[model samples]
Target: MTSSSIAEQVSTFNEGFTAQIGPELSAVFDAEQQALTAAGRPDDAVGVGDQLVDATLLTPEGAEVSLATVVGEGPAVLVFYRGAWCPYCNLTLKTYQEQLLPTLRDRGVGLVAISPQTPEGSELATSNGSLDFPVLSDPGNVLSRALGIVTEPTAEARAAHTQLGFDVADSNADSTGDIPFPTVLVVDGDGRVVFADVHVDYTTRTEVDEVVAALDLLP
Candidate 1:
């Protein structure tokens, strides 16, 4: 198959797979939300000074790296997601790559994307999405859990995933299982999170223009 055909096939497969798994995913998400609410953690609580913690991520080629190193001398935009397996994430990242990255760069901002997927998967995401920014691998969701954003998949969700032929193990070799919900955080030079959006609903995402406006407000 041609590259375009291969990409199309992947896209089609992902779409059908996501649809097949949606009900189980939704159930897990709902249960997690209820648990967090019971635990007094609001869905909208992602923010600054959250301190991403002792998390070491890898570049697409497997080099050890940290978000601190990527956030030098400028404001940084960190896009965190489960993996490239999510279509919503794929679209969101592609939109940022095609639109927001240049606009942010022009305004002296740096863009980086983080996920629980391996470097190989990250590389596939970057290449498939045409992302210019670095895609970092969070391995075991250590960074995600540190930020209080990790959500474990229910057994039903896991079974659904398996049925759909969605291999979390294959996609994120370092991760023990499924990924966290999609999140975005804007951090200033001092490592303070100036802006954050922890999406409860997988289909919804923060807009690029809204991010630009947030960046505009920073010093």
Candidate 2:
């Protein structure tokens, strides 16, 4: 509660990015902001009380893991990220690992991060975050698309990313140029969404303390 929201923290980081990348590359963010106008926000999402789909994902070790099984045990925290190439995603995940994971584990809440990246990229993310929880691959972003959180990058965004030395195709398993919005959904034992934080802006994320507060409210 003493610290800033994850969005606020990342906004500070993004200022650095915007300054480093200059106006033309920064304009891609402008385009993305416009696109978010048509995109699904968390208020319209499968929110508090709506059940989640029991989707399957591939672990970094290439094993198939079921969301159903995870949530069946108790509460689950699902984090959808853009992938290892994204600095914002790494920052969010790392913060969760340091500030959120231990609390969730103590409460018997399962924490998993899902991304449309290859197993290799998942490995990079896990190592980067020093994550103790599962980092799953979404393959073609099938689950995220089903949840109405999927979006394809604009050409300008792609070019800007490439200019920054990040190749989405190299990280994503499908190479489809599509990704999920940064989202965090807390599902209870019955697989219903109790807390949903889906951000239209890629620079933002669900704060760790907020997620813990949500988990505390879980019945």
Candidate 3:
């Protein structure tokens, strides 16, 4: 059996790290999550059988790459993250890179990660995580906004971020600090969404086995 499931791993980190960081910082983070959850989540977003909308995203190298081009190629999996600054996002992306990318390549499925950070920030994340897939910058959340997953941080959350040294305003080109719901969408060649999972809680993510099972059902 696998040593630990992703949920187990994240739970362990959440418990141990929070303890190590002291209650003050931990409470701030918890409050932030609560605020986000309290803010009504987007319900009219994309769904299974719905076509994934097309948008242009900035590559790490500062070039434009369209969802049109990405979805046209065989099966594609789009992983939308909060930002490289978030530890949970880092862990999730690294996990996907280590566990999901190989099978995706073998199966001829395209994999891409998107975040609302600046292009430079996206490049930093790709390099730091050693991610082989394209890391796209969704500036101003053009795609996220269209998909109805865009969310702005609360004032308390922003203050907590400042305390944590994550100046999202400075790092993101859009300067809004708007982020997605840690979403994953699997699209077929025709741009139809075969699988769509959006985690309102940023601490969680869609697991590797889930992706494998979803891909197995693809035509």
Measured by TM-score, the strongest candidate is 3
The regions of model 1 sitting more than 4 angstroms off are 1-45, 49-54
lDDT of 3 by residue, 1-219 (tens): 234556877998898888887798788778877766676456787788987788998988899889777556698999998888877887778888888888898999999899889999899889878888889999998898878787767777788778767777777778877788889988888888899888777887899889988997678
The TM-score values for the models, in the order shown, are 0.79, 0.90, 0.92
Task: Give the better candidate number (1 or 2) by lDDT.
Answer: 2
As for candidate 3, its clashing pairs are none
In candidate 1, what are the lDDT values of residues 18-55, reduced to their tens digit?
Answer: 47657666466456556544554344456766644546
Worst 10 residues of 2 by lDDT: 37-46
In terms of lDDT, which candidate is stronger, 2 or 3?
Answer: 2
| Order of the predicted models by TM-score, top scorer first | 3, 2, 1
- Cα lDDT listed for each candidate: 0.74, 0.83, 0.83
lDDT tens readout by residue for model 2, 1-219:
225566777778878888998988888877887787665584445567777887888888888888676556788999999999888898888888888888988889999899999988999999987888889899999889878788767887888878888878878888888899888999888887889888887776788878988986688
Candidate 3, residue 95: CA error in Å?
0.8
